[model samples]
Structure formats: C-alpha cells, structure tokens
Target chain A: MQKSTQAGFWKKNQRALAPWFFMAPGIIMFLVYVIYPIFQSIGISFYEWDGLGPKTYVGLQNYRDLLDDDSFYTSLKNNVIWLVLYLLAIPAGLAVALFLNQTVAGIRLYKSLFFFPFVISQVVVGLIFTWFYAPGFGILPHVINFFTGTPTAILADDKYATYGVIAAGLWPQTAYCMILYLTGLNNISPDQVEAARMDNAKGWSMLWHIIIPQLRPATFIALVVTVIGALRSFDLISVMTVGGPFGSTRVLSYFMYEQSLSEYGTAMGYGAAIAVVLFAIMLVFISLFIVRMLSQERNA
Target chain B: MRSLKALAGLALGVSLFATAAVAGEIVLNSDQSDPAPKKAMEELIADFQKANPGITVKWNNFDHEGYKSAIRNFLTADAPDVAAWYAGNRMAPFVKAGLFEDVSDVWKDNGLDDALKSASASMTIDGKKWGVPYTYYQWGIYYNKDVYKKAGVTEPKNWAEFVANCEKFKAAGVDCLTTGDKGGWPAAGIFDYINMRTNGYEFHMDLTAGKVKWTDPKVKATFAEWAKVVPYMSANATAIDWQDAAALMAQGKAANYVMGNFAVDTFKKGGMTNDNLGFMIFPEITAGIPRAEEAPTDTFHIPSGAKNKADARKFLAFVASADAQTKMNATLGQLPVNNKATAADDPFIKTGFTELSSAYALAQFFDRDAPADMAKAGMDGFQEFITHPENIDAILERLDKVAAKVYK
Candidate 1:
C-alpha cells in the first residue's frame, strides 16, 4: 500500500520535478560558487585577517583605511581610465568589420587573419607589447629614438604606464569585437540594404539609420564584454607593469590580488574590501546591461 | 551477468586499496622546482631513506612563486609533515599563528645552537627556535671590470670614493648603479647596505622593527647618502627585472649592481666571465660601524598539526647535519648555514661564504628581515627614491604612515 501511494505521488509530480532535476547541477553550482562567495566576501570585509592566522573583526576599519589610502585612489582612477579607453574597441571593431564585409578573392583568409589576435592569448599579447616597449633594446623604443632622439620606455614611466597597458589590452579586445560584428554583418538582410540604397542613404547615413540598428545584438554583447573586461583588467597589468612604476598602473582587480594573494600581500580583509568596492562599481553597469537585455528580450 | 558482477567486484577492491594509507610515510612540501635545487632535494630524500630505512617520504614540489601562497593554504588545511620556508620575519607569521611546530628540541638535541649559530638569531623568536636553517647566500655590490676600466675608475674603497666614482661614471655616460625594482626586492638590498653603513645594523633593525620612525634624523641621513648616488642609477630601472639589470652590467652598460650572490648565475648566462665580473662589499659610510652583511637563509619546519612529528623531526636533524648541508649547498651553489659545512667551489659561493662568515653580524636580506607589508612599502619608497631622489621627505613620510598602521 505504501509503495503504491509513493508511486502515485511520483506520477503526480513527475512533470513539475523533471525540470528542477535537470537544473539541479547548475543551481547547486550557482549557489556554491557565485552566490555564497559574494556574501562571504562581504562578511570578510569587516575583519582584519591574514590568510594563515585568526581573523579579527575590526568594524569598518578596512573601508575607513581605504578612504585615506593613496594607492586605493590611484587604482580607482586607473580603472576609470581603462573603462573609458577600452570602449574604443567597439567603434574600431566596427570599422574593421565594415572593411572586411566586402567579397574579395580570398576573403576567408583575410577574415581569419583579422581574427588572429583574438585567437591568441592575452599573455602573449602582453609579452609582445612588453618587448616592443622595452627600453634600450625594444623595437618601438628604437623607432621612437630614431624620430625624437630620446628613447622613452612607456611602461617604465608612471604617467604613461596605464595607457600603454590599455593599448595592449585593446589589441585582443578589438579583434574579439570584430569577430562579433562580422557575424552580425553576415545576418544583415540584403533586401533592407538595397532599399536603403534606393532611398539615397549611403555610407554614414546608411550605417547610422539602417545598418547599425541591425547589428544591435552584437553591439550589446560587445559592450557587455568590454565593460566587464575593463573592470577585470588584471592579467595584462600583471604581465606588463605589475601595477608599478610604483603602483600607478593599478586598477581595482589587480589591486585586490596584490593586497591578498601576492607573495608579500597578506591583508586578506583589506583585499576583500577592495573586492566589494569593485563589485559595487560593476553592479551599476551590470544592472544597466541586464535591464537592457531583459527589455530587449521582451521586445523580441 | 557474470562479467558485470566481476567488474563491480574489481571496482570495490580498487577503491578499498586506494583508501588505505601507508603506515610510516611522511609528506614534505617544498618549492625546489629549479633543476639544481630539485636534484638536491631528491638526493637528500634518497640519502635520508637509505639512512632510515623504516620510513618513506612523499614529496610535493611546487614552483617557486606559486609555493609562497600555497604554503599559507596547505598549512591550514592538510598540513605537511615537513615544509620548506625561509628564516627570519618570513617565518614569523606561521610561528605566531602556531602553525609551525616548536623545533627547539630538535635544535638542542642536534647541537644546532653552536653549529648553525650564524643563522640562530634569524631562526629564533620568543626565545625558541621554530625551524632549522640549511643555507644562505650573501648580498653585495657586483660590478663589471670592463665598465670600470671604460669609466677610468678603480673599485672604490669607501663611500667618498664611491660617490666620486659615480661622478666619473656619469661623465663617461654610464650608470654607476644598476638595479631593477620591478620585483620590488632588489632595491631593498641597496637600502639595507646604505642603512647598515650609515647608522649601523642595530638602527636598521630597530627601524624595520618599527621602533624608530621613518622620518627620524638618522633615517634621513641614510636617505641623504642615498641621494648622492641616485643620479648615477640606471634610468627607467623600475621597468626592468633584476635579470635585466644583470644584463646591463654584463653588457658593460652599467658599472655596479647591488645584488645577491645568486644573480651571478644570470650574469654568467649573459656571457660574462668571472674575470670581468667582480664582487665587493658595499663601501663604508659611517667609518666606525661594524660591517653587517645580508645572507638570507632557507629553512625547513614541521607543522604543528603534522601527523608524523617523529619522522619530521628526524628529517630536520638530518637536514641540519654538516654533511647533508655540504652536499645540498654543493648542488644549490649557495653557502650552507652550518658553520663546518663546506660551500660550493664556485668563486661567487666562495666569496659569499667568506663575507658571510667574517661579518660582525649577519642579517637576512631586507625583504626577509622586515615584515612583508613594510618590506614592500620600504622597497617601493627606495625605488621611488632612486628615480626621484628629491622626493625623499615625502617617501619617508609615506613609509612612516604605513609603519604606523602595520606595527599597530
């Protein structure tokens, strides 16, 4: 009788339980890795802890310390610079995609060639740029020396180091955006473009009024990736300047790693505070992106 | 059906066997990923197993940089029976946290007190030894004879002559001092030598220990002396690695590099022969000060939570022996901390051994001596001072601010 009743319950709920059973792995992962850590990080930000030792609750001390910290302010400023400069990838990617849109003899080869930087790793790009700007021996410095008679090591100078790292980041980031735009370009309707051309719309007007609207989804994804990329600008800085020329090139993400996980860094609580601030900044743009994505989904 | 039952039986047997732990095995974690150090470790383990046949060692070797952070994690989680670390303030965090076992008994029983006396001060905190120091290497001014000849200057005997030679090197369009602070420890070596020369080792220790203010007049005096040499340092040094700076000296583009004995490898790899590569003690600044040299030590410790403390202590004692140290240092190309142990026959190691032994006192290098946070801030200040010597007051003030918080 109990087995028959249990079987009846299973038969009744099978349809409702099936979707949840399928989603259990993803739901468990999200809770464990993403949701729990965010709260744990926030909890840790109130304490003073070295990773090896006992943690002491200091009650907002880490954030209070950040207010007076020049390095903190420097990182915040550099992150702003990264966010602003990194967006240039979108327009630059659009330009490259527009140029590559034509049917040429060996167009597939040219498309893959343009996509080369994206296929390679960010570390390789950083290393290539490091060699290019290396003073006394690097090719770029040699060329600059030929023109100006004074060789400048851009990564060595605090004033220009962030921009130099940003330039390296932009190389691969632009290539990625170009690939997205090229795919979006492929799905553009020939009939609409033909109609726009018939209406005397060409070049800039054609792009502004007709073609760009078709590429909206690609532009949205590019913006999302670029914004997140700017927020998490760590690897290039780590490989290139290491947040140096005395910490001038530091952005928030690199600053957090330097404070917590680096060889000399043991201020775990302070690092968490930096992480919270970065998360808060990211939340603003993330919410905006989400709202746009949701509204677009509804519209579609 | 019969085949399926056999497969299930096999899987269960494999699982049961895999779950069983070895009875007399001890695990050791160390960062000796380089060829020489890894081979030395392997030899040490083989020799140890041959001597003590009842026990076995399971070693986990990590890359150098990764091990620094990994130690903190593994010490808290699955503690190793033995761990490789550094002496001095580098080990202080583990010691204070009670993660490291008090191996003072091992030291006493093994007579490491008199044998490893050169490193005993660095190994001790709260009047108890936390680990056994196996090896150390000295730091000093390494220069290029070719560059010196080109600049028309001989090796300086004292601070005045060193400063005067900087002028000549400047006139000859060569950097008198080449150091890369990208890793942020090389510049600290320069600061250590200058501070030890200017105010003495005691004052420098007090300063790093946070008893003295960074803006103290004595500290300012150290900076004043540093300011005299800053103009002759390599341009854009912050962008370069220590290896790059060694390349500068090897290429004869720079005259003097304040570095550790280990950098001799990089210099040799850069096509510099021992004939043209010279090692000298940093010149005397305050003439009456007793010479103090930097010789950072490598150590091994048993963790407090280690399951096999008996075998770990035995391993520590074995590592402390003169024979073991001699063999290990021969492979490492470094000076063994055990007084009776012989260093490698390499010229750089010989000079390091002589200098370390003869000094009035030995210090761990600045980064190892100072607390990590302070070491980083101090190195950054020194690097900035190298570039903008005029910003001395501001840099010192910033260091004082950090010291105020860190020591508190």
Candidate 2:
C-alpha cells in the first residue's frame, strides 16, 4: 500500500516539476554570470588594489573622491541627457510601426530595409558616424559648410562630441524599438478595433483609449532596453571619441575602462568603485521595474 | 545495435586518450599581433621543441588592448610559462608580488651584463632582476621635410627655435603639430618632454615616483610653455589616432608629429620615405637643464610557476642575444635595446638609432616611468590643460590631489 501511494504522488508531481527541471540550466547560468559578478563587484568597491599584491581597505574613500571628480559630474550629466534623448525612440518607433503595419506589395522588403541599421553592429554604426563627422571631406561637414559657409567638425569640438555620439547611437536603437512595436501592432485584435470604430472613436483618440493600452508590454521592453543601453554606453564612446576632446564625452562605463585597463591606467580598485556606483544607480530602475512586474503578475 | 554501441565506445575511448596526451603543452602569452613577430616566435618555439624533444609550446597571442585585461586575469589564475611585458614601474608591482621568476642566474650566465645594462636598471626592483630586454623604440618629433620647407622653417634645435618654427608653420597655413588626445597619452608625451627639459632627468623621475608635487613651479612652467604652442596644433587632432596623425604628415597636410619610432611603419605604409621624413631630438630648454629622451622598451618575463623553467630561461637568453636582436629589429623597425646589436638596413631605424645614441640621457617614456595610476592622473591633467589652457591652475590642483592620493 505504501508503494502504491508513493507511485500516485510521483505521477502527480513529476509533470509539475518537469518545467522547473528544464529551466535549471538557464537559471544556473544566469545566477553564475549575471547575478553573482554584480555583488562581487560591489564588494570589491570598498578596497584599493592594483590587480596585484594585497588589497587595502578604504571605506567610502573612493566615493568621496567621486565628489570632486569633474569627469564624473560630466559623465553623470551626459548620462541624464542620453536617457532623456533616448526616449524619443519609443514614439518615433511607434510611428514607423504604424506606417509599416499595412499589407501592401513589397512591404516586407520596406520593413527589412528600415530594420537594416538595427541588424548592423554598434561598432559599424560608430564607424559610419565617424566617417560622417570626418573633418574635411565627410558629407555632414560639407553640408555644414554649404549652409553656414564654415565647415564644422562635430567630433573634434567638445561642445558637440557627446550629442553627436548619442545621435549615432540613437539611429539603431530607434530602429530596434520600431521593429518591436511593429510586432506588437501585428498582434492587436481586429475585433476590438472594429468595436472602437463602431463607438465613433478613431485616429488619435482610438489610439490613446484602446490600441495604446495593448502596447504596454512593447513600451515596457523598449523603455527597459533604452535605459540599459544608455547606462552601458561604452562601445560608441570608445570607438568614436575614447572619452576625448578633453574628456568631454566620457560616460561612466568608458571612464571605468579607462581607469582600470588602459596602458596608463591600472587603478583596478578605483575602476571597480566606479562600476559599483554605476551598478547601484542602475539597480534603482531595475527594482522599480521588478516591483511593477510583480504587481502586474499579482493582479493577473 | 550492439555493433553501433561498440563503435561509439571505441571512439569515446580514443578521444579521451587523445585529450589526455595533449594536456601537457606549455602555453605562452604574448601581445604582439604583427605577423612577422608571430611567425618569428613560432619558429623559435619549434626550434625549442626540437631541442627539448619532450615538451610542446602553445602560443596565445592577443592584440594590444585585449592583452591588457587578459594578463590581469591570467596572472591570478593559471598564468602562462612566458609572457611579454613593459619595463619600469609597470613591472615593479608584479615583481613585488612574487608573480615573476627571479632570472638573476640566467642573466649572469647569458653575458647580458653589457647587452641589457639599460634594461637591467629598469627591470630591477629592490636589487633583483626579473625580465629580459627585447626591443625598444625612441620617441621624438617626426617632421615632414616638405611641409617644413613650404613653411620656410628648419627642424628646431632649441626651445626658442621650436616656438618660432611653430609660428612660421601657423603663418604659412599649415598645422605646426598633430597628435591624438583620444587616449590622452600622446599629449602627455609633450608634458613629459617639457618637464624633463625644464627640470633635469632626476627631477622628472622624482615627479613621477611621487617624490615631488604636481603643482611644483617646474611642473607649472611646463604647462605654461605648452599653452603657448597649443593653438598651432592640428584643429581636428582630437578625433585622430597616432596612425592618422602620421598619415597627415605623410599627406603633407601637417608639419610634424611628436610620436614614437613605431610610427615608421605607418609612414612607410603611407608611401613616405626617409627623405620625406626627418627626425630630431627634443630640444633643450636651457643650457643647464638636463634633457631626457623618451625611450619605451619592451621586455619578456617568465612567470613564477612555469613548468619548464630551464627552457623559458633559454628563450630569454636567446631573445637577448645579439643575433636574435638584430634579426628581430630588422623586421620590427624598432631600435634594439642591446647596445652591441648592429643597425638594420632600414634607413628610418638607422637615423633613429643615431639620434637615440646621441641624446644626453635616455629615460623610459613617461607612461612607463610613472606608476600606472599616477600616469593616468598626469595624462588627464595634460588633456585638461591642453583643452582649456586658461584653467591650468585648477587642472594642476586637481592633479596634485590625485597624485597625493595615488602616491600615498
């Protein structure tokens, strides 16, 4: 009788636990690579070492040093600018999605061409912009000369270097967001749209009251990606300016790399400190997102 | 089914045996990416393997930037049996941590006493030698003779002449100098030159070693003089690299480049010859100010836990040998660190060697002379001063604080 009881229990629970067993590999990988290093980096922030010899404990010293670092302030300010400007991608993406959602002839080809920038690597985007901003013979410089009678090198000037790089970054990011919105639009219910039309609602009002609510998931994903991309903007800065023109275009990620790993930089402890600070700043947004997601789950 | 199972088991057994047999190879880490260096090292390894008969050498080569981060992680874990590294304060911290093998006996046996006298000074920490000198290159002003002639100016011999030439070049509608500040170290070279020329070599060494302050009058004067020449630099220099700056000189768009001798290859690739390019030692600031030349050296080190220490030491001795240095530098276009090595057929290298030997004193370039942390602060100070020359005092003050923190 006991054996029969155990068999019945196993039969019921095995199916339920199968999904989790299948998830184990992914969960372990995520925990090992993504979750653990973050905590380790934060812990290392409170010490000083040159990646060799003994580590010295220096509580709050690195943070205190940040208070007077002009580059840090410039980076923080540029990060804020990047975050604000990056949000334009969402609305711009939605507009493009709406335009491309029709089943016209060769519409697939149009969508693919529009999505080409997103498919290309960020390194290529940086190179393209670098050529675009090249001083004497590049297209943008020639255009500027045509308009203002004086050619301007966007990357060489400190005033425009950050914004110039951000514009280049935004080109591909906007396309990605557009493709996501297009997918979301394709899944919208035709019955709901017909009912909204029957209620004399159309155009902007219909989009606001009915169709827009359904795009919440798409918007959430877009916002999350944009924020993360803005925070982790190292590659574009590295390839385009290398935190140059007097360190005017330095973001935290690039600054950390410059401090820790460059030929002239071996301050691993200070770099880790910067990384920890950036991670902490990113955590606040992540926590808010998690809380919202959890509340939505509970409501469902 | 039984036949298939037997075949699978046999294959698995063979694979496992092959893996086990191949696990004893020694890995070597290097940062050289040029095909010539890679081929040269591979040939050397093949020769070593032939000599040893029982060991294998595996090469792990990384590009310049990739190797910087890779070395840090590799040293902490399973480091390679041999690696390439920079000399000076860069190697001191590693030596202090006992991460490098003491190759004193090997140095003594190889008759490297005269071959590596300069490198020995840079490699020694607390009276222990830790590395073998490989190849080093000289850094100085590389000017386009055509541009200088067009500007009606000659290569400057002193500070006054250099400034006058800069004014002449600017007046003649040419950029007097071109350097990339993207990495911030190129500008730091100018700062090092000014400091070394303003004060003596020992004083410049003291400044980098934390024995002196950043806000010292001598340091301040270096920036002051640098401000006078800032406007004459190429307008779009910040967006370029050292290679691009060399291209400008090759194209006859820029008057001069203050860079290292490694730029010889870039110039040659750009179709510029030795006749089109001229070399000059950085001029003196005053009659008594001891001028120090910037010579960046590359060296090889054997890690402490190497499995084949004898073979690694043999490789080191071979690298420092006169024949090896001559062959390597012939292809590398770099000045051999060994004084006895004959100059190659390359005219650029021959000229560079003559100017290097004629210099009053040879100081390992600024980035190597200073600790890495201090170098960053100093370079950042240089970039700030270059961009906003009026804020020199504020920049120096900030650097002074950073120097205090790092040096302490």
Candidate 3:
C-alpha cells in the first residue's frame, strides 16, 4: 500500500518536474565546469601563489601589478584589434554564402571546398599558415619579394606578427561564419524573399532590409562566438610565433599561460588576475548578449 | 534484481581498491616518452626490480612539453613516488616550495656525494641535496671545417681573431654564425657563453639568480661584445629555428652554430660528418675570465608528498650509480652525471667530456639557469638586441623591469 501510494505520488508530480529532470545533467555540468571555475579564478586573483606553493592572500596586489605591466596593455590592444578585425569575417562569410547560393552544376562540391578550412583542426591550420609565412622559402615572402623587390619576414617583425597570426585565425574563423550563414540562408522564408524580389529589393539594400532581418538569430550567435573567439586567441599565436619577436603577439590567455602554467615558476596570482581582466572584458559582451536574448524572449 | 547488481558492482570496486592499496607499488612519472629514452627507462626499472625483488615499479610517461605543465598539479595533488625534472635553477622553485624531498641521506648512503660530485652542486640548495642528476650535455660552437678551411681561417682564440675570422667567412660567401632565434633560446646560448666569458662565471650566476641587475655595466659590456659579432650572424636568424640554422651550416650557407652537444645528431642527419663538422669553445671575450661551460643536467626528484618514500630514495640512489647512469645515458646519447662513468668513444661526446671536466664551473644554459618568466623576457630582449643593437639601452631596461618583478 505504501509502494502504491509512492508510485501514485510520482505519476502525479512527474509532468510538473519533468523539464527540470531533463535539464539537471546539463545544468549540473555548466555549473561545475563553467560557473565554478570563473568564481575560483576570481578568488585566486587576490592571492599570490606559484601553483604548487601555499597561496598568500595579497588582496588586489596582482591587479595593481597588472596596471603597471606593459605586456598587459599590449595584450589588451591586440585583443581590441582582434575584436574589430574578427567581425570582418561575418560579412565576408555572408558575401561568400550569397555568392555560392546559386544552384549551378557542382555547387555542392564548391561549398564543401569552401568549408574545408573550418573542418581542419586549428593547430593544423596554424602550422600550415606558419609554413606559408616562413621567411625564406614561403610563398607569402616570394609574393612580397616580387612586389617590393625585398622579402619581408612577417612573423619575425613585431609590428606585423600579431596581424600575421590574426590572418591565420581569420581563415578558419571566416569559414566557420560562412557555414553558419549558409544554414541561416537555407532556413530563410523563401516566400518573404520572393515577395521582396517582386518588389525590386536586391543587392546590399535587399540584404539589409529583407534577408538579414530573417538571419538575426544566426548573426547573434556568430557575434557572440566571434567575440569570445577573438579574446581567447592563444593556440595560433602559440603555434606560429609563440608571442615572440619580443612578445608582440601575446594575448591575455597566452600571457596568463606563460605566467602561471609555463615552465617558468608559476605566478598563479598574477595569471589569475589576468584571467579576471579577460573575463571582465568578456562579461561586457556577454551582458549585451543576455540583454538582447531577454528582449527577444519578451517579444516571443 | 537491480539492487543486487548494484551491490555486486560495489563489492567488486571495493575488492579492487583493497588490492591496489595492498600492492605497495612505487609510482614514477617520467618525461622520457621518446623511444630510446623510454626503452632505457624500462631497462633501468627492470634491473631495479630484479635487485629489489619486492617493490613494484609503476612508471607513467608524458611527452616533454606536456610534462612541464603537468608536473605542478601532480606535485601538489597526486604526486608520484619519483618524478623527472631538470637540474640547476630549473629545480630551485620546487625545492624552495618544499615540493621536492631532501635526498641528502640518499646521497650519503650511496656514496653519491663523491660519485656524482660534478652534478651535486646544482642538485643542492641551501646546502642540502634535493634531487639526483642523471645526465647533462655540453653546449659549444659547432662549425663547418670546410667553410673555415675555404676561408683560410684557423680557430679564433680572442675577440679580435673571432671578428677577423667572421670577415673571412663572410668573404667566402658564408655568414659567421648561423643561429635561429625564432625559439629565442638559440640566441640565449650565445648570450650565456658571451656573458660568462666577459663578466666571469660568478657574475653570470649572480645575474641569472637575480642578485645582479640587468642594467649593470658588465651586462652592457657583454652585449657590446655580442653587438660586434652581430654583423656576421645570419640575417634571417629571427625567422629560422635551430634545426634550420644547422641546415644552413650543413649547406655551407653559414659557417658555425652555437648550440648544445645534442645538435651533433642533427649535423649528422644533415649529411655533415666528423670530418666536416668541428667543435670549438666560444672564444674568450675577456683575457682573465676562466671559461665556464654551459652543461644543463637532467635529473630525478622525490616529490615530498610521495606515498613510498623508501622506494623512491632507493631509485634515486640507483640512478646516481655509475652503472645505471652509464646504461641510461648511453641510450640517451647524453653524458652521465656520475664522474666515474665511462663515456662512449664518440667525437662530440669526447669533446664535451674534456671541456666539461676541465671547466672552472658549469652554468646551465640561459633558459635552464634563470627562472622561466625572466628567461622568457631576457631571451626576447636578446632576440631584439640581435636585430636592433642600437636599442640596447631600451632592451636592457625592459629586461630590468621583468627581472625586478620575476626575481623578487
């Protein structure tokens, strides 16, 4: 009789709790892996540690040091450059998607080929670009040599190193945006596009006034990921230049890795401070993203 | 039925845990994931197991770069009984933090205080032994004999002669020194030898240990000497790696490379031989400073948190023995740290052995001797100095800023 009563209780409450039950695993994972680490890093930002040694509570000394660190400014500047330049990929991707949207023969093959760079691992892409930018024998230098009558070592020049790495990052990143735009284009309400076409809307105006409004969801996601991606640019810099030519290419992520996790004795507090700054910068974009998401939810 | 199955699984997990706890195994983490070193480690462990007859050895291997990052977490959290690390200032932080066990007793019990005396000073901190060094290799100038002969230049002995020889090599269509500073440390070997030669070994040690300032006039003098040689260094040095520079030497595009003894293999692979390849100590920059060589040693340590301290100490003692070191370094193509071990009759090995044995003191290479952050900052300055020697003041100032922060 007790078992029957318990089963009866479960059946009655199941519908009300079902959604939460389904979301429990994902919520738990996000909380543990993402949310917890952010708080832990923030807490560590106040402590002076060498990763292995006992941590000393320094209370904002790390942030004070960061204010004086020239490398920190350089990384901040580079991150801004990455953000502004990385957004170029979205429009470039949209252009490529529009160009290839035609149903010509072998169009599928062309689309797959266009998506090739995104399919490759970022590390492999970095290696490929490093070789391409190699000073003496690389194709990039040869072309530059032909144009200017002098070869330029792009990655070795501090002024050019970050841009070189950013170009490599942009190659795969642009391909990624292209795929997203392609999917968004496929999902566009054809009848609305046809009606716009009938009304003589085409080209840039058509893209602005008609098609893009329909692709807002895709655009929002692209902006979020691209902003996040630009800030976390570590792997390519590590692979291509290792922030070298006198630390010209270091971002906050790579700088933090160098400080806390590298073979150099760990400056855990300093690295955590850097992480906090990076997180705060990211939080601005995330907030804007959340507000936009909330407004969309209200409209729905 | 379901509850019984769950109970069975729990019972099995408990039994397995009990067995593991009862095993009394000593775990070792190694960075010798390369085939030859891995095999040598296996043989050494086998021999050790045969001798002990009781303690089981569980060895885990990680790749070199990954091992560097993984070591900190393991040392603090899940430390193995024994772990491999580099000697000299590279091991200082771990020792300072009390992460490494004091193994002076192992040195005393095994007579390693005498047997491994050459490496003992580096392994010691605060006058206590912290780790046992197993292998080290010498760094020197590896030159192309063909290029030198074609230029009609003999081995240079002093600053003036070295420059004149550079001119000769340049006239012969070969650059004087082929170094790749892309990784930043190839130029650092040049810096280490130059600083040691100019300011003496004591100043070099003091500089790296952060006792001396980067803006010291002596440090400037070292850069001044390096600046004199800048005209002869490869123009493309900032773009190529060490291997690429070695290829330049092999092809006679460049005359020499200043690197560790390990480059001998690359030289051989690049089709240069003992006949064409010759080794020379970096020429004296100052008349009176005794030549202190760069010979970074590879070592093993007992993590303070180890579960099996006895077995770990036993392994350290065994590693310090001439027999074990000889077998291991023979496979590793490196020099044994034990003074009593006999070296293989290889030309490069013989040269390194003679040079290191006769040295007044051994300073590990720049990256190994200095703390990691300082080394990174210093090497970057060195690379920039090579490109823009006129900006020496700025570079040294930048280095001072980093050294002040890091060495503190």
Predicted candidate 3 versus true structure: per-residue lDDT over B1-408, tens digit per residue: 699789987876665455342355788998998787898899899988988888889999999889998998788757789999998888888898899999999999989989998888888889999989989999999999998888899988887898888888888888998898888899999999989999999999999999989999999999988988899998757768788888888988889899998889888899999999999988888898888999999889999978789888888888888988888888878898899998777888888999999999999789888988899888889888888889899888888888888867
B29-116 per-residue lDDT for model 1 (tens digits): 9999989899999999999998889889999999999999999988876678999999989999999999999999999998999999
Q: Candidate 2 lDDT, tens digit per residue, A1-300?
A: 999999999889999988999999999999999898887787777888777778889987878888778878988888888888888888988889889999999999999998999899999999999889987557898899899987888987789999999999989988989999999998889999999999999899999988889998999999999899889998899889888777788888888888877766677778888998888889999999999999999999
In the predicted model 1, the residue pairs found to clash are none
lDDT of 1 at A126: 93
Structure candidate 3, residue pairs in collision: A264-B372
Q: Best candidate, lDDT-wise?
A: 1
lDDT of 1 by residue, A1-300 (tens): 999999999999999999999999999999999999999999999999988777999999999999988889999999999999999999999999999999999999999998999889888999999989998778887888789988888988888889999999999999999999999999999999999999999989999999999999999999999999999989999999888888889899988998888987899999999999999999999999989888988998
DockQ numbers for every candidate? 0.72, 0.55, 0.60
Fnat (0 to 1) per candidate: 0.68, 0.68, 0.68
Report the C-alpha lDDT of model 2 over B187-278, residue by residue, as the tens digit: 87888887788887888889889898888898877777777789888766667666777777788888878888877778879878878888
Query: Could you tally the backbone clashes for each prediction?
Result: 0, 0, 1
Candidate 3 Cα lDDT to native: 0.88
TM-score each candidate. 0.96, 0.91, 0.93
RMSD of each: 5.0, 5.8, 4.3
